[model samples]
Target: MTPPPGWYRDPKAPHLERWWDGTAWTEHRRTPEVTAPVPVAGASGRAKAVAVTTAAVVLVAAIVTGAVVLGQGDEEGAEIETAPTYYTQAPTTEPPSPTPTQSEPSADDPAVVTDELNGITLPLLDGWVRPKYVAEDDVVMTTDGTYDCPADGGVCRHGLVMSRTVTSNDERSPEALAKEDIKEAAESAYDRDTIGRRPYGGMESHEVVKSGPVAVAGRAGWFVRWRVTTAEGPGGYVQSTVFPSRVGTESPVCVRYVFDAGADGPPLADMDRITKGIRSVDDPDGGGGVGSSVGPGEG
Candidate 1:
């Protein structure tokens, strides 16, 4: 009888195994085929062990890849967070306001007047010179240059007269000049031979009066009067103080003149004319004259 065409083995229990197909057994085996014992019970356990080892290797590989991806994500996030941002703001402003103007004096001002003396002309009689006298130093003298009244009138009514010297360049300010003149007048008492010096003859009292704001030589000046007691003489004593209109290192010069009040009479009436004629040369728009050009230097 013929056997099946697929692989077949001998049915008899033998140490050798043989393959047969259809009607014939193959003679291909040069050596006998050895058969292993059948492992009936442990076959499933071996298959399970192999499956567990393969699963463990796959899990380890997946874990390593997930760790690398997570590390990359963290690095990228840090870089983004550290970057800088840009921004801006607005500008400020301010507001505005107005301005004002100024004014000056006019020709109609009443204090103005004019005079001429020794070929010098000036505006006179504003709030300029003050009248006062110094009682010390040299005796001053005067002759009227011109007057509102005639010279023959023994009364000597309306002209002004005075005497003084430019003592020192140190006397610059008006106050300093005044004080120096006064000190000089007091010392003049020692010079008895001088014209206004007379011994006081037991007179009970003395007096002095001053007037000014006169213009002389284009500048402001003052007038002064003094009445003093005589140590030995008879009539009331009188003296005059005249200051130069221009101020200088040697200027605004002071003059002291002793007069016979008995001869020139009281000086009040004449003082009015002197004060009225006083004037100031307007200061030049830029600056004025030779004095302005000259700077201070040793005398």
Candidate 2:
């Protein structure tokens, strides 16, 4: 039997309690009756206080593999904290809900980076590491090290792979979405980031190198790739991949890749390998899994 709706320790942020609305996690959150933080060595009491406070406001990053690194600041040498926080909702009883579709964290596996919400898992290849910042339904993996960013006087990774279930756009064809996303993906990766971080010294220009049909998780898809030239560092390659998800409602999904065009960057072939390795969490063999009976439209 499904547990009745109640407050429970959040599977992601254990110190705080999240409301379990019988079937899923809700927006409601409250402090636990008693909570003890997992202590970190070298962290001052003040820092720990700040971390606890900051975590409450932004329960974004969850462990795709290990800990999520939260940057304290950009004061030349601010300490970074690798806190094992952020979570899904956990039920009270030992026996859990039999229906996997009841929760977004149903397929969660800490041993590998899996986006249960998106119903897909990207391959964890050598030279790549689970990123420090991952939001709900969004997954990102990047190179293990960073390089000096020429424009922003910051550090930048030479490679990146990110994925998310597409919900904003109404376009149904994967090809159309892929074609449209290539430009934005290039700008985001090479030119500037959300916080105006000019990591690649700002992209100078870009040209399409590849565009065509592809297959992901046994679903037909489309991908568009570009070679970008930047004002600093080595230029990079960026691509936008779109495919229909095997999850509920056949939702569209988007995955993007970035590789700095230099020796330090991941091998270009790795992109193809990664794409080929994409598989649904429910369909590890890439058989596309079973489609949801629930969908939009009039029967």
Highest-scoring model, lDDT: 2
Model 2 residue runs over 4 Å out of place are 1-112, 133-137, 284-299
Decoy 2 TM-score against native? 0.57
* lDDT on C-alpha atoms for all candidate structures: 0.35, 0.71
Q: Can you give the TM-score per candidate against the true fold?
A: 0.32, 0.57
Tens digits of per-residue lDDT for model 2 on 137-250? Answer: 243577787767777876677788878667777888999999888888888788877777786678898888999999988899999999999998779899889999888998
By TM-score, the best candidate is: 2
Give candidate 1 misplaced runs (Cα > 4 Å): 1-160, 163-165, 186-191, 195-206, 211-218, 222-224, 234-250, 262-267, 278-299
In terms of lDDT, model 1 sits at 0.35
Model 2 scores a C-alpha lDDT of 0.71
